[model samples]
Target: MSKGKTDDVTGTDTTGHSWDGIEELNTPLPRWWLWTLYLCIIWGILYTIAYPAWPMVSGATKGVLGWSTRANVAAEITAHEGKNADLVAQLLATDMDVLPASADLNRYAVARGGAVFRANCSQCHGSGAAGAKGYPNLLDDDWLWGGDMAEIEYTVRHGIRNEQDDDARYSQMPAFGEMLEKDEITAVVEHVVSLSNADFDAQLAETGAVVYADNCAACHGEAGLGDRSQGAPNLADAIWLYGGDREALTETVKNARFGVMPAWGPRLTEADVRAVSAYVHSLGGGE
Candidate 1:
């Protein structure tokens, strides 16, 4: 191979390499393209120096300009919170029971509460508050611990059957499988089914009436309307938390269901709890 050679046909300089008698040309890149590439590299270096870049052990390096998207977001949040400070103060000061009397305050609470609900409560109660198998539906009037604004507020503050809060709405249904015979438990389930307008064995339900009277009537009322004081759900209503079917009821009576709700009082501000309470109450289920 030669270091430099001229092609006879085109009179262009060869790159001193050839394959199959075809010589490679020593053609230079266009000056404009070369300059553009150089400028891009410079711009990238400048941008990195002027903004957040270069990952570190703790976090990214604070560039010369100290620009931070997180800082910007925090600043915006602080500004918004400052603007809503007055409304939040009023919300905290006002009693939850009579909150609806002030239309503007109630409106603000509901709107704010909706946002809070979507962020925190949506996982269990669903985005629409329709609830799942174990979670109680918030959109219905069948509340285990009462559906009034005050009650809702109290439940939201203290929570239900949780170990975190001492004042949590607590209730423990005895496992009938351990206490009663299999036949007796089955009869009781039949009675519960009969109460809910579902098909059931009349003979089993008749026998279940006696079992229910002896055991369930203490918490679930004689008419199966439930006792809010004890957080006992109404067996008569079709809206069941665990489920109303025979198999589900059997499982419930045997092992018992212990659903827990976290106390929002410790986690959320007073305004937030009240706001969410108001929001839940306004969902057409409040008494």
Candidate 2:
């Protein structure tokens, strides 16, 4: 039963509803605001008709304009690829070994390779190529294989001891547990440990030296200098893929270490392979 009425105090129309002693005034919205709201409503309707809006079972409605965000993105990608096609072709043609001779190509490869490494190699080798346990640190001075760019490329292409790739770099260290007596294994562990650690038992090392000379010397070298030819690790240098401690050396000598790296050759484009190799070589460890 509320009706509009004029208030005596301000001479403004009252809404005829009051709480306590206060009355509400019938104030209209700004003209500009009302006009804007109407325009928005109209715009929304046109937008629904002109662009993808309503959803269906399989997809959204293709609006009258026949435009798609996905199509736009695909076109953009195609254009980008066209722009870089020549560069990519050049990269592919260039030998990874001599790619660095071209300053511009090297820079481009390194930049591209860094991105590739982050996406693919960073999981095992770390973002900085510092590596984790069981993974060889790419940033280190030592390498199980050669540390140069060409060697890195070969390793990346062929992989290490991977059954999937027949051309993989393959090496075997005999499980001394099967070959050597328990005392001999223990002594060999002591000798290998003494190669790196200063406080090893000299008597045990002397005993292990004979066993080492007989077995480990061929691959690991008499001076324990790792042979890159056989992928044997240098014990005397103290750098270890596993660890250089006595217990670590003991386990390695007894059990043996066989690590596998999946070949990138099959999956990645040649340019990508070279780029990632270049990036790895740029890491402090590379010769």
TM-score of each model, paired residue for residue = 0.90, 0.76
Residue 221 in candidate 1, Cα distance off native in Å: 0.9
Model 1 misses residue 231 by how many Å? 0.4
Which runs of model 2 end up more than 4 angstroms from their true locations?
A: 1-75
Model 1 shows how many backbone clashes? 0
- In model 1, the worst 10-residue window by lDDT is 1-10
Give the Å error, residue 217, model 2: 0.9
lDDT of 1 by residue, 6-62 (tens): 888888898999888778988889999999999999999998899888999999979
lDDT assessment of candidate 1: 0.92
lDDT of 2: 0.89
Q: Candidate 2's residue-wise lDDT over 121-191, tens digit each?
A: 99998998998888999988898889888899999999999988988999998888898898999998899
Model 1 lDDT at residue 96: 85
Report the number of the highest-TM-score candidate.
1
Which candidate should be chosen as best, given lDDT against the real structure? 1
